[model samples]
Target: MSRTQRVDRTAVRTRLDRVTDPELDRSITELEYIDEIEIEGESVAVSFTLPTAWCSPAFAWMMMTDARDAILEIPEITDVAVDLRDHMHAAEINEGVNERLSFDAVFDDADGDIEAVREELDEKARAARQYRAVSALLDGGATPEQIVGLVRKDLTIDSEGRTTVRLDETLSICIESEPIERYLEKATATGVANGTDAGLFVTPEGETISPSEFETVHRRGRLAATNMSGQGHVCANLAEARIGSASASD
Candidate 1:
């Protein structure tokens, strides 16, 4: 094989980073689920293991499809295979992806638009992101009404104050303002109304709510955040166990 035909590891990894786990809206790579990346002449094979063998077939298919699509984006690659390991539906998923079949084509009982699912997840992620920034502002002594009326320009993050929230060397995320950025990105991507009239926070339906309704919205957002956090904890544990077991067996 010519040197030019070899896969570019860095480019492939960067591409994979954009392919996220549908449920968590997080990169599979960041979750450390990618088990292998093999380059053979013009073909590149990517393999990943799930947190559990019985993980949702829908989510498994979503990741596999996204991964294969990402790899195909590189003009240099002519062929790619996405492999899902140790999962109950691995065979189905592998065949579905390798054959370029639709999700419903592989699963007989599947119904409704997959885009609906993606949109729902995107909304939840948007809410979760907004919750972080709002809570941060609240802790910094901003009022509910003030938050409800805020525009993007009204937002400001003081690095020192954010660092103070960490207060420990191990707390690396305290100073980062990704939540706000994520919220904005999701908002823009989904075409949710933003700016002075609608404020930084908007309903899942993409409409502006009154100041008096902020409490209810804020409380609901917190609950959504809690549920997402709990799910995240469960996934983290499963990933740890799966990764550990794989390592031991190796």
Candidate 2:
């Protein structure tokens, strides 16, 4: 019998939290897409489901690969196996991810490049994140100039336990941690600098969206957010139905 390294369930879940649906820009965990997780010896097994069997193979493949990569970060995990439960291309994706094949190698002559698709979605996510962060500041009475000037080190929990982010020592706005978490994750993925003084409202190219263009950027950001929200709701409903069907069958 192989001796297994002690596995922490919390740690495993924490790692998986980093994996997000490419289009939705939401955590697989938050999206309720991670169906199950099992561990044996140094091997980790994760079974996940998508919104539907017909979800885009490229996006589904990314989620699976991201999960496997995230789990492998644990020193105790020497192997990771991703099972795509009900996807149309589940078999192809599972095999491709396990074998570490490129998207083109997995789907030869496919219409789109996976990297390009990923970048497109990443830009949308960054726009959504920046809009949400800046909007929260606006709601809390921050001027447009102040919102644009905000930096990463501005995020902190205040004495009253509310999440607050600041543009300077005396200019802080109260907000929740969810949007901040969302922004930071996508910011890093989009090549934005992550540091205390790094600007919060940056374009996909890692350049700060100028205050003069704030209105246009905010409008575009809101649109991006609305599109993702609609997609997320559809996926959530489909996932619920799938889960219900599985339970009835069981």
Write one digit per residue (lDDT tens) for candidate 2, span 97-189. Answer: 998998899899778889899988998988888788667778878887887777777778555546776657666667766666667778888
- Residue-by-residue lDDT tens digits, candidate 1, 37-146: 98777788999988889888888887888888888898888789988988988999999999998888888886666778778877887777777877876776666766
- How far residue 116's Cα lies from its native spot in candidate 2, in Å, is 1.6
Q: Give Cα-based local distance difference scores for all models.
A: 0.75, 0.82
Clashing pairs in 2: none
Best by lDDT: 2
Clashing residue pairs, candidate 1?
A: none
The count of backbone overlaps in candidate 2 is 0
Q: Would you estimate the TM-scores of all the predictions? A: 0.75, 0.83
